[model samples]
Target: MSDAAELGAFLKARRAALDPADLGLPPGISHRRVKGLRREELAQLAGISVDYYTRLEQGRAKNVSDAILDALARALRLDPGEESYLHNLAAPKRREKPAPRRVRPELQQLLDAIQAPAFVFGRYLDVLAWNALGGAVAFAFAELEERNIAKLSFLGDRGKELYPEWDAVSREVVANLRTEGGKHPGDPEFARLVDELSRGSAEFRALWAEHAVREKAQGWKVLRNPVVGELRLRYETLRLPDDPDQGLVVYHAEPGSESERALGLLASWIAADERPVNTRSPHPHAG
Candidate 1:
């Protein structure tokens, strides 16, 4: 979608998610007719006119001021990530042509050196690179043809079994994808992935429609591995400043927990195998 169109959809979604009763906006038949606060209510809260707000939502407004965007963000109760997304949709920069991302040799060395589960995700959440233990703990990155993380999360390789908290994990995956999609409006690869998932999974379609933008940083990840049963670990997502399209996700368990021992066992399994796939995991940007 165009940035302006997306800007409008985002405004509508956020407005639909709020409650007039909580804000004491004098609920009545209109409140019941619509799901959330009326457009006029939101415009009043943001100190804008109803006509102007409607224009903004219809993608008809141009050269919007930062003050207006800020007010809208505050009125919508957007989180930092969502707020950033809102700004991107309001004022987009030059579009970069979709290009394939490659994990540098040194970066791959770093992944191999780390004793934890570490892998790299590309612009569309493709598993671009991973160490031995990383592959073992998660899905075998070497075994898959399409290593896109979002696709695996929703459609392939018994991923639901791999992620015990499937519902939360899947929702967060869609949100992250949404954030990426917003950054590069009209990206064909993103459109392909979205179309594919929307056709394959009903739940994914519902979450995608919600327009909730999220970027994963650091969090507790639980995995139910066929090899090691339930393995709980902490994960950190590190983005490369030079290559904004790539991010490294590293996972570790607590020092003395069974989860740590599970990592050790996975390490042993990885050490025994010699999968000669390209560890850099070079994949073409979705066509």
Candidate 2:
């Protein structure tokens, strides 16, 4: 979709999600055609003219001011991520073509040094690099034919089996993808990933249509690992400052918990498997 169309859709979806009663508006006796606040009602709430708001929603208004955007955001009660997404859709910055993603040597070293499960992800949540435990604890990073997380979460059955909170995590993944799509509207790879997932998965199609925006940060997840059984881990995502398109995700369990013991067992298994590694030339494997 074009930026204008996306902006309009986002505005329409958010507007429809609100209730008049929540915004201190009385429910009229007349039958309402729309589900949420009317255009005029939202305009009044945002301190803007009805005509101006209409034009904005219809993608006719160009060069919207920050003040008006902030007003609209407040009127819609958007969270920080959603508000930022709105601003991007409304007035996106011109972007140059993105380069092919590569894991930095330093990042690879950091992943190797970390005792916990750690992996680096690039655009579209591609597994750029992962340590031994990362591959063992979660899905095998080396085995995935399609390394993109969205494709794995929606299209791959293993993802559903792996994540105990699969439904919630899948929705969050879609939201984060939506945020990335808005930021890089011109990226063909990102666009292709969305198109492929939407075509392959009905659930993905339904969720993507909602246009939710989110940032993947700290979160707790329960995974049914084949080796460790049920492992509950807290994950933290750290974005590579120099490379905004990449993030390092590390998973840890609380001290002396069952999950912690499970992690320790996983580490031991990985260590035992790697003990007989040859010092000769390493075989190249696609991630």
Candidate No. with top TM-score: 1
Question: Which number leads on lDDT?
Answer: 1
How well does candidate 2 match the true structure in TM-score terms?
0.91
TM-score of 1: 0.92
Give each model's whole-structure lDDT: 0.84, 0.82
lDDT of 2 at 231: 93
To one decimal, what is the Cα RMSD in angstroms of model 1 from the true structure?
2.3
For residues 139-217, what per-residue lDDT tens digits would candidate 2 score against the true structure? 7766655567787789869779988898898888899899877767667777788899989999999999888888888
Worst 10 residues of 1 by lDDT: 278-287
Question: How many Å off is the CA of 2 in candidate 2?
Answer: 0.3
TM-score against native, each model: 0.92, 0.91
Question: How does model 1 fare in lDDT?
Answer: 0.84
